[model samples]
Target: MKKLLAFIFLISSFAQAQYTINGTMAPILESDWVILYKIEGASQKYVQDSKIKINTIDVQGKKQKIGTFSFTLPKDTEAGSYRVTYKLENAGYVDFIFNKENLNFGFHPDYPEQTVTFSISKENILYRKYLEKISNAQQQLDSIQITALQNPSLDLKSAYQTSLNKVNSIQNEYLTNSKDMYVAPFIKANSRNNPSEILDNPQTYMSNIIDTFFYDVDFTNKTLLNSSFLIDKITDYIFYINYSDDPNTQQILFKNSVDKVIYKFKNIPYKKSIIEFLIDQFETTMNLELIDYLFENHYYKLPKTIQDQKYITSKRALFATGIGRVAPDFSWIENGKNFKLSTLNDSEKYVLVFWSTTCSHCLNEVPKLHSFLKENKAVEVIAFALEDDEFGWKNYKTNLPNWHHVLGLKKWQNKIARTYNINATPTYFILDKDKKIIAKPESLEDVKTFINKQ
Candidate 1:
């Protein structure tokens, strides 16, 4: 009876063991709290958030406020990858592995990835070492391979062989040590396929790399699917593998890479997630052509549940006003006659300027712009003055008589201004003879530069 009781007690104790994650941020700046999240696939599951406790510490004869926050994980917490986000700007967050172990780390908020250091986490410490050592070895191998390819006469076979051996050894060692831990799948998935022998031809070497890029990765692994590995891997494959000097050729390469990447995944949700990520990436860079291609080729084909029609409509609206698309049409009353923008066929190009009479910057730049365009005949300027009332605009338009002027009441709430998605005063859009938007200049200088180039 006594022995049975002792065994049961030991089992219970092990089951109830709790884990903790403690974080410290130096020079916390304006951030007052931190949120902890469990990263799963393309999303983050919010676990908890904590208010930071500031402590003033003297460093190098100067006082600094160091911020500290912590999260106590329940005994049954799922083990995998976790993220702590302090701020949203410039990716102010740190990712670490958690496997029923306590983690204590510190980092500078501005440079979290570069400066994060762990003090008391076995899983994280080993993972950090593995990344550093493996990355160094791989870089050395790449350098030697590139050098040998560049100078075929140079004898770099020995150096290349050594670097390859080092990479293999480091990878194998980490795989072995982390087999029972949460980081094993990450290490295995991150392994690169290296050539056994050096090749003299750059084209052949690159071809071999591209062929074997996804050989070591297991797309079906649940752990990999639940973490950021798959997305990161897909991103690397799509954007980093193919390069071309010609813009058109580069775009074709990108499409090919996307096809290759999408073909690797069998899960529908995963595929949808990757497509969404790609759309966001291209949208940020203002690559409307690629965005259109993705929507027509991939995004629109997905099932309705994952289609997100609202998001699709918003994206379409965004593209409607983009640089290759036709500008939205508007009309105004001039001398008891209604005139439409699309009906104007007077000039080879048109400049649409959205400005407010009350805006100081607009008041300053519009006059300068009028003077600059006085000598140019091929381009016609149409100025839309967004205002709450026409009193200020009527007084201001007398000086600039060369350009066609339209008074837009309600200022920011004006329909014409909203149609163009105007958020700031003095916004400029240059349209071609076909009424397609050719360029959206940032400032008066940009407008001058565009006209001068044409």
Candidate 2:
């Protein structure tokens, strides 16, 4: 039993392997704090232990931060790409492989992209030089293109084309040389052939790129998953490359791409992050409909941890708040008369507003709504103030005496607010005469536009 216990201890120690990162930076200020971020799935999480100070070290009369910045990776850490960054401007971030090996490096704050010197691995050094070459080529091409545009001469146009070809050639050569390195995939993903057949037919080109972008990429590779390179590439491919005016088609493409990636990920953290990323993208673009598809499949299948459950609930509520649904009925007392939302002036179109007195946006918008309602007799305002006390609502309500003003004294947790899934202040729902939600407007402008159309 004792021997077995000792063996287990040895295995635990092996899993807790430590890696040391020794590096230096010149032209760095002591006030600047260096941060290290570990890429997890689609996100970059800051490593608290990996932060190092930019202390000064003097070499002859000149000074450098070399040897002053060093951090040891925590034991049993996942092998992936780690990034080093500084708070100072133009001191661009650097990423390195953390495959259970110690790293030795030096860089200058002035020319981080061009001047990174790796002492331990020839792989990283070559990658840095390749990056510098690509960067310089791009810069030259940009200059040539600008000159061509300004002059519009045949000679200048020819020069621009030549420079662009040279950049592409250099990129292809670098990728060929660095075939097996971790950075190879990144370089390949980023380098695009100049003015190709894709430019002539953008839609077909974008669709082809979207289909084949991940062909060479190993989506299940933990190292690749942890690197921002893959996620960044995926983002650009989905958003920039696959630019479509038809939102229905765009949503389908986005969902298909996300589904493919998520299907490849068995790792819980990676899967969860990818799912969350898609959800955020949908929410940001106001494509709330796609969120229902996500929740119906990938979201519910994830481990029902507290965070996951919270996210699922939030998204579910958002999906439910879409148009054509019957507005949740609630009773409110105003002027000692009991009023149910569905029964309140069923003859006229109603605007249900979930607002707060303390919210500055509501303060500005509510008065505007009041004035607009007074002019337009076709619609009435049902303003539900999500406030803890009645004093603010009472004061604000006095001016807008014609509207059906109700005090949701429980604030955000008020039954009506929760039923409607009101997360933000000044939320508005345009209800038909029967109290069915017809439109969810973003602002007073949207409300005005909808009413004007009617």
Candidate 3:
């Protein structure tokens, strides 16, 4: 009898342990649905929606449908931030923190003036108030700043300074009081220019700012993984620190940013997230060599849990066709004419363009590029369309008749695109007469700049 009772108690405790979220969407139609999104793999995507049901709930001591909308987190769900969005006309979404607690939110879909309201969750309730206070304070500060800038009087300047001081005070007070809350570190990370610090040394203000930016941030805090606030804070910290105009200086600054972030993130998952983000950003640039550097220095040093063999292989592939490396040549067959890349273009330089007719960006960039290259006889365009069919290319070929147009049989998995690692449409690579990659311009403007430099 004792054993059976203990077993029953354990089962009940496990069953009762779960997070519950209650929401009210006013002016909601019968067919309208609400979506729940949780952060997955360093980003958020649609998970599932609440089903429409006619139900009753206690609303101000009365039963109603408006109060009946509720959803429960999965039993296996981890504690984190979740976003609730109602797909009603002109209605946005609301975010709240959940950690095995019952939380409630009230919002209106059509009315912008009706701000989101929360109950039962102390952290979310404080976050909403903090947002409102910041919004109101910013509007007042803007008015004062405009007046002071337009009319530079001693009194106006003093008032502007006073307003800034008050804003900093409010932020500091919140930081002290809400230290345990999820939003506290975010507020501290964003707070800037206290009166004492500003008055002491203006020259070293930026250095001070960088040192204290992530002072309170707990890299291992799983709660932060549920929201984009942490990611945005990381991005701002890296990009805004030690900005420079000189390309060499800028490159060093960027490299340092990655190294600093890797050193700070003690948690394996968080470290992996940041490393992947940095790798992705570098992959878009001609500076893909940075990815190789990171892989060798930081990524390889990480524990095996984060640095799997497949991930290492993928990173190596990105570095294969980096800047200063010879552009890989491929076969092009069009109208029974087989030609290698080197044989097609006899100009001093060649512009290899990988585009698809179906892509909207290609539609705009291709024509602009064709018009831009009309007078430049020194550079020839070897355009390859990665298309499933030649119909779209044939129709669009009239506008671009000057270049050597080749239709790739496979759309994304084309043999040439695979060789060159062309993941995005309208990718441009500027090569010399020897087929050596000189520049891989990001956009049409970049292409023009590279051409002028040449």
**Candidate with best lDDT:** 1
Which runs in model 1 stand beyond 4 Å of their true positions? 1-17, 26-30, 56-65, 108-110, 330-340, 355-376, 385-416, 443-449, 452-454
TM-score of each: 0.83, 0.63, 0.59
Tens-place lDDT digits, model 1, residues 98-124: 888899999988888888889999889
List, residue by residue over 367-421, the lDDT tens digit for candidate 2. Answer: 8988877878889888889999988778878888778888887888887788788
Q: Pick out the ten consecutive residues of candidate 2 with the lowest summed lDDT.
A: 193-202
What shift in Å separates residue 287 of candidate 2 from its native position after superposition? 1.9
Quality of model 2 by C-alpha lDDT: 0.74
Q: Which parts of model 2 are misplaced by more than 4 Å?
A: 1-32, 49-70, 74-78, 85-93, 100-121, 130-208, 266-269, 301-307, 317-329, 333-349, 354-372, 387-399, 418-454
For all candidates in order, the CA lDDT equals 0.88, 0.74, 0.73
Question: What is the TM-score (0 to 1) of candidate 3?
Answer: 0.59
lDDT of 3 by residue, 1-454 (tens): 9999999999898767766777776545554567888875366677667764555667689766652367776667765667776655554667666655678877765552355788878777777777677657756765665554455443555665777777866776777878876667556555544334222233454566666767766666666655766776777876766578998888888888777778887777767777878787777775766777777787788887667787776666556567777777677766687878766557999898999989999999999999999999999998999999989888898889778888887888887677777899999998888888888899999999999887
**What's the number of clashes in each of the models?**
1, 1, 0
